[model samples]
Target: MKKCCVLIPYYNAGDTLLSAINSIDYDYLHPDVIIVDDGSQITKAADVLKEYIGPLNIILLEMDSNKGIEHALNYGLSLHGRDYELVARLDCGDLCKNNRFSKQVKFLDENPDCYLVGSWVDFTDMDGRKLYTVEHPSDFESIKKLMFINTTFTHPTVIFRSNILDSVGFYPTDTPAAEDYAYFFKIIKKHKASNIKESLVNCTIDPHGISTIKRKRQIKSRILVIAHNFSINKYAVYGIIRSALLLYTPRGFTVFLKTFFNPNR
Candidate 1:
């Protein structure tokens, strides 16, 4: 088995989970995989993965109740720690570029001091139409500064040094939709993290929950994360103000802004 492990949290994704798995570049490394089911009734993890024809090392863990992604992630991490050096996150319907895993492992190996590294992501629609490209800062200093504003690492594009779990534990449960924001902040506070300059993942954005209610909860949780956040830098102060502004900013306006930045229509 390879030293890396891919963790996917599942919730009735149907064939899209296969799309995500098929994008893994097994040529570089067929790492161990763990799929955690978030009380999925319609699409059982076993049935969805039955047709998969790759290395037969995938492990499926099912939650009895619909606890949510945060719980599924923690459950997977707590049980799948079979001496992996790295843990990569992948979500259903997302596609990884061919060199995604190889580049992340190589980066971590070369820079032993770095505990986490994400890549730029190509955001797209279900029909594979490009929405926008998210390019975060590639260097550690820039990443640190940007974290004061928002999460630089998109969930599926990130690969973490497994030891960070030993150091920081699992994702924070109270952050609601912004659990990832708080989770990364806790780690960035202690370890060096960066992003690859180039896009290595196709992150499919679902427009289902982009409503006022959901966006308010997410922005509120993010503001909480930034307010309790520890930093003496001016960026931290600006971050609080920015998040507060986002709490009032309309989600549609932000979507329009991001769409305007999309190089592809």
Candidate 2:
């Protein structure tokens, strides 16, 4: 099978960065793991690179200052993206399940029409306690419809074709905290997208992570995404209502409601 690259944005990731890097099945993926350091002054990503020994090609790109994840991601992709046919994403703390990269690459390779593929993820607490699993739609039609409500692909669980950049471009800075939501929405509208039917990664739920810290901004951004991609349909109307409603609710409530009704999870 052909090789793929992985994009990881790190800022004060500490040991979780190591866990994320170590989880990749290097031999199978033969990954060019590009890590962008978003000015991590404390508990740096470089600290892990210094002590590690591995077969995977781990490239580190350091920005002059902190510009947030969107900038770091685009920086990495702008320079390293074209060299590979596929790009996979993993956050600093997420652990790739066995055969995750291989399976994703193989799926994209065999199914030429599918531009993006993600997997269900296992969410865990800081102590590695199981929180919940998020299962996304596996069919293109369902994904396109459900995306109106929320992003179907968990960012960390996705591996997408590089050429889609030609159609959809890089992650949009305008989306603020919900760039992936907007980007994935663009792809599904233009091409087929789906998820593998099983959990392919373990994503630790960081209480102070960007999703939590910028919860409100993300929800507002989701509003913009939904409005911009608006179409007249039952799911679309309900999606707008759900996202707008989420803006008023606390993050805990939204998380609880989603977990309680995970839709065939």
Candidate 3:
């Protein structure tokens, strides 16, 4: 079997870290689970993770102070050798479906030219009960609909070839909120990309997560993404304005009614 490693970046996620770790059924696909501790103040996370340290090759990289997710991910990437073909990502507070790694690895093995592969996800509550499903777009056009909006790919469910990182480099540290989206724009829009049309992962969302609280930051980062990808000329401006009015309209009777009635929304 080809080697794969699960790279998890941790902060103050002591509350849900162990459950995320345990949810990975290592018996089926024993990938090296590397946890990059991004200066988590929650000391109990260390104790909880210690219990499972011996059973798996759990490598922990601790930073003296809290750097952001990009730093932690770069640190994790630095620890691995060139032997590993695939690097899988999971956030600290998220859980992976039982066969997440198995299915992704199989897809990559069959599709040699494909650099990155992401799966559809079912969003769940903190208790791990299913709330709703987020379907992924099957082709490039449908995926482009997410240039301003980010409904195409769930970050945690993505697995990419290590070489792509070598080519495009690590996640952007500058744009903190939409770093993943910015990276996707560079890789998929600038370069070429592909996705597998399979629902292979479950994404858990904490209602009070940082991503939700920092809405303005996320929107600002997205604006940068638009500026970087599209030319600031008249034609691009018109396209962006149309997309913004269609996609980013506030939650109101009109917006909700349109989304509710539209099959794609």
Highest TM-score: which candidate?
2
What is candidate 1's lDDT per residue for 1-265, written digit by digit as tens?
2588899999888898899888888877778788999999988888989889876368899999888788899999898753687899999989999599899889888999999999998888768988788888888888878888888899889999888887998999998888888999999889999888889999876766323447788888888888888578888888888888888787768867898977754
lDDT of each: 0.85, 0.87, 0.69
Between candidates 1 and 2, the lDDT winner? 2
List clashing residue pairs in candidate 1.
none
lDDT tens string, model 2, 115-211? 8999998887789866678888898888988999888999999999888888888999998889999889888878898899999999887889999
Output the better candidate (2/3) by TM-score: 2
> Is 2 or 3 the stronger prediction by lDDT?
2
Distance from true location, Cα of 92 in model 3, Å? 2.2
Report RMSD (Å) for each prediction in the order shown: 2.0, 1.8, 3.9
TM-score of each: 0.93, 0.95, 0.82
Shift in Å, residue 163, candidate 3: 0.6
Question: What are the runs in model 1 whose C-alpha is more than 4 Å off?
Answer: 209-213, 230-232, 262-265
Distance from true position, residue 182, model 1, in Å? 0.8
Q: Give the TM-score of candidate 2.
A: 0.95
